[model samples]
Target: MAFDEGDAPGRVVNGLSVDVEDWFQVGAFEGVIERDSWGGLDDRVERNVHAILNLFDEAQASATFFTLGWVAKRHAGLLREIAARGHEVASHGWDHERVFRMDRKSFAADIERTRKTIEDCCGERVIGYRAPSFSIDQRTPWAFMELAEQGYLYSSSVAPVAHDHYGWADAPRFAFNPLPWSDLVELPVTTAQFRGKRLAAGGGGFFRVLPYAFSRWAIRQVNRDEGRPAIFYFHPWEIDPGQPRVAGAPLRSRLRHYTNLEKMAGKLRQLVREFAWGRIDVIAHREALRLEAEKATLHRASA
Candidate 1:
């Protein structure tokens, strides 16, 4: 998505991200969707994800898929298809736990488990992460440093902007390093400064919830006006609106989770056409290296 569609002092860098997991893998629904039930849902998972894969393939685009360890373990073929088609595999943690909710040891273990699972399935070492619910924010800022220590090259876990479940309200919207210890890159989800508030860009259910016009405007504002790359994220099930709806979820969440699924694919296609986009790793790595070089120059100058 373009940060500013028309006013770009710089080109809008686009990165598409997908949290690859079954419907049961989402954090909010973890409480309601028992993990044991996930195995039996494999067909549903592949069907949903394959549709997304096919869409990206049709666009001649690639994305970073932050996959659940459980899903990767059982659905190796899905992970393989994503890799075969040129997408990058990344970790979404095991069991979809909120990072801040777990102790450091537990959190690290989750990362390792998920990373290994993805690597085993895709034959590529997973180097990035996007925490479930965007939970690696201020409360779990340590997660970034820990991820670096675990050999991760970067993380897309911080939403940066505030939300009901997760955010580092003060963090930068563009890609940057989490300082003091982390060498890992932090790529926050795209949110634009609109009328002095951070509103979600073309990412996740937020994109689904807003009028398509608003999302396009937000993304364009970021690209053209703000001079930053925009990261758009969505789940596999989002495009599969016809999937069975869950029972007993909170009314608001049920609404948030299910509303407009049928329209998501069309919306996604519109989004891809409206802006230039690439894989998150490509964007993140290119930016990280550039930033590092810039930092080294500044350090030399200061010295």
Candidate 2:
């Protein structure tokens, strides 16, 4: 019962996405745990994810979930529940490894493994990938070519805004195909280009940590000024403040993940009400070809 484009009350925003991994699997905490130790946790991801799904159901919204292959393999039913509810199931990678951390062979293999796992779960060709922590920026440009070769039509992996962890400080705010890679659509997370600096507008720890009015104004500027759709993303755990907290992590990382947990659900509700948002695939279906063609035109014009 999700709302269609015409049904939403506000200006139609682009897409909404969720990174579907357990709280501990997040890249910010990756440095804290031994690789094998991550499995020892009791996999409360579905419990957390279902909460967000319930919220979306209440809002009459459809979204995309970038699922980890490890989570999908064990919780195929969870993946099915997502697809059953008419949301898109995309890949977050096999084990949530950042692209720059792995060589090309390992990165490609991870992508293939995750794509097959998700395809098996959903019985549809998975066509998108969101890199962990937006790790596939300029440092790992090969990711775009690899995603194109693997038949992925779009990537929402570039953050564009500068962050302590990752950002392509030079990338565009609106969707665009980078030089030499026109086949894959690059949907950088929505950020407003302000006074020569790119400030993140959509969800991230920044959205949670900063004042909500700032986020609202940023999206408004993007739509009114740029005439481009904005992208937003969030995590299920953000809505669940009472979830068990991880121990032994750095003070800063713990604060980043846990602070304002109680406020996330309310902030998200305000965001959805203030702007129109839809599933990523819907945006991709509409824009990918046009973007590719636009790139070709630009190339021809330059030549």
Model 2 misplaced stretches (Cα beyond 4 Å)? 1-5, 8-10, 179-182, 292-303
Predicted structure 2, TM vs. truth? 0.92
39-87: candidate 1 lDDT, tens digit per residue: 6763477888888888877766667888888788989988998889878
Which sections of candidate 1 miss by over 4 Å? 1-11, 41-43, 300-303
**How high is each candidate's TM-score?**
0.92, 0.92
lDDT of 1 at 158: 76
lDDT by residue (18-114, candidate 2, tens digit) is 9898877887688786669877876678888888888788777788999999999989989999999989999999887888899888999999999
Model 1: lDDT of residue 216: 83
Each prediction's RMSD over C-alphas, in Å, is: 3.6, 2.5
